[model samples]
Target: MTNGPLTLMQQTSALRQAIRNQEHTGPTSGLATGAMQGNVVILPKEYADEFLMFCHLNPVPCPLIGVSAVGDYRMPMLGEDIDMRTDIPEYYVYRNGEEAERCYDISSLWQDDMVAFVLGCSFSFENALSQVGLTPRNIEEDVNVSMFESSIPTKPAGRFYGNTVVTMRPYTPKDAIRAIQVTTRFPKAHGAPLHFGDPSSIGINDLAIPDFGDPVSVKEGEVPVFWACGVTPQLAIKNAKLPICITHAPGKMLVTDLLDADLAVF
Candidate 1:
């Protein structure tokens, strides 16, 4: 491997190691380029079945990627060396539906009955967008992608339910069309823009203020394109009010050894 910047073809084990060592702890967008990045949710085994069903019913916002065995931090399906407790850039520990704390590692809290779920992330499709010259605004500005709670509701499963959350990317109409085509090939990665143009249509009142992550400029000629985000699970976490729930902080993700191309359909 080259001793320079990571690329779309790069393996992500080293990046995972860096995150594990606390060398990097910020939004994971644009890093570990070719690997599939995943949004994480770790909860008690009791909630695992329902959450799995939730993913099945609401695939766009919660595409099932990998699931760790009960209490096992090692996600062999995603990576041989991945440790779910430390691979993500950051984590949110929620207590009874409220965010109690944010931390870099969750080893201290990982329980014997905890089960981790990995969901497909839009970050996995970004390189394809860039390849087609339709780079997302957040990538251009180097900020965590702006995510907002949308009016669109997800299909409920057991006790898990909530509105879908979406990440925005500003693009000209022509670019958006191309972006949709590129993203559609990666169905696991939230597949294509959900809505574009008016934010009000999706119940997002202001483009300047977002519920999670930093905002980027939506250029005058560019319209905002929305895509289902894995962060949607956070809303479900809030609604379920489980004794404990852990998730990747918005925008940060688990960079896995799975290849982005492996997620593409054609």
Candidate 2:
């Protein structure tokens, strides 16, 4: 790519190709602007039922969009020619509820009994926010969204249970209200802010220290807003202690061909 800006379609294609070729390995925020990005989870088919049930119990943080057939990498419902093993910019490999390694590609690690899931992401609504003059702070600062694990416990399903994870964006009081209105139109993208004022109310100790992704500035007049995040599943994955699990790195999502507007209710 060149220093000149690329159109949304062009950027989408470029990022897709770059990721496939292992040439780009960075946070995917603000790219492919209107595309519906998804949080990824790959696990053995045996664990699929429990994990799927967990998503049902926590719709706000785990709105599922697409799921691949056993051993299949293609997600036909979300996009064309998507390969689960190589599409995401980065992936976290976990073994027995412990961190394993981070890598750009996982082709060799893929298993025949594995199933892939695509969950709705907060990035999906960023375009709508930008169009309405309420661009997210992460987008404005060109960084991955700030994510933190909250004390709020999720409903249990089988063996899957964990605390909720949230993404943060800072906005002034008036703009925060407008953001709630705009985001409520896209339920798949986490609907609306869960909390907008004090970080401690949600068990977050500091805005500058995030559990995942980069921290953006919380200016003088702005207050940090929190939204249910797809990363909540990672916590469940850890708690479940499955033999193996694979997920997209926080802020690095699976960019689908679907348009964000298509997911909006109104």
Candidate 3:
């Protein structure tokens, strides 16, 4: 490996180590270029089956990328070195479906019976946008993407049910069209824009403030384009009210070893 930060694999490993040590606790967007990133959800074995079905019924917002066996914290399918307890930069702990706390490391709370689920994140497609000269504003600003709770409903399964959550990116009409085509190739990365133009059309009354993540400035000639966000599963977890649930913070995704093209539908 080169002695600099240019190597993709080296950068990914270093980032993961930083996260594991609680040295880096921020969004994963625009880092580890070309590597697939994932939204995380950890639940006890008791709720694992229903959550699996939940993901199956609602693939758009919960595209299943990796799952660990009961009592296992390592997700070999996503990364051989992945430690579900500490790989993510930050974690949101939920009790009775409500966010109770945010923490850097969950090693103390990890249960032997816990099962971890990894879902594809929009960051995977953001790389594609950048490759095609349509870099997302969040990347340019070095901030987490703006995420909102939409009025759009998700397909429910058992007790898992909630509205879809979306991440926004602003672009002119011409760029938006090309962006849609570029992203459509990565279905696991939320595919295309769920809504563009009027944010209120999707129940988002203010683009200046977001339900989650840092908001970026929307240029005068640009329209806010929305894509299905992996954080949507967090909303479902809140509705299910399971005794306990764990999820990656809104924008702090788990950077995986898989390549971006591995997630492209094409």
- lDDT, candidate 1, 24-126, per-residue tens: 8987777767788998999999999999999999998998999989989899988888889888889999999999999999999999999999999887788
Poorest stretch of ten by lDDT in candidate 2: 1-10
The C-alpha lDDT values of all candidates are 0.89, 0.89, 0.90
lDDT of 2: 0.89
Q: Give the per-residue lDDT digits (tens) of candidate 3, residues 1-266.
A: 46664677878889999999989998777788799999899999998999999899888888899999998999999888999999999999999988999998898999999999999888888889999899999889988889899999998888889999999999999999999999999888888888899999899999989998889999889999999888888888999998889999877889899998987876
Residues 129-222 of candidate 2: C-alpha lDDT, one tens digit per residue: 9898998888888888899999889999988998999999999999999999999988988888788898998899998999988989999998
What's model 3's overall lDDT? 0.90
TM-score of 3: 0.93
Q: Which regions of candidate 1 are displaced past 4 Å?
A: 1-11
Q: Report backbone clashes per prediction.
A: 0, 0, 0
TM-score of each: 0.93, 0.92, 0.93
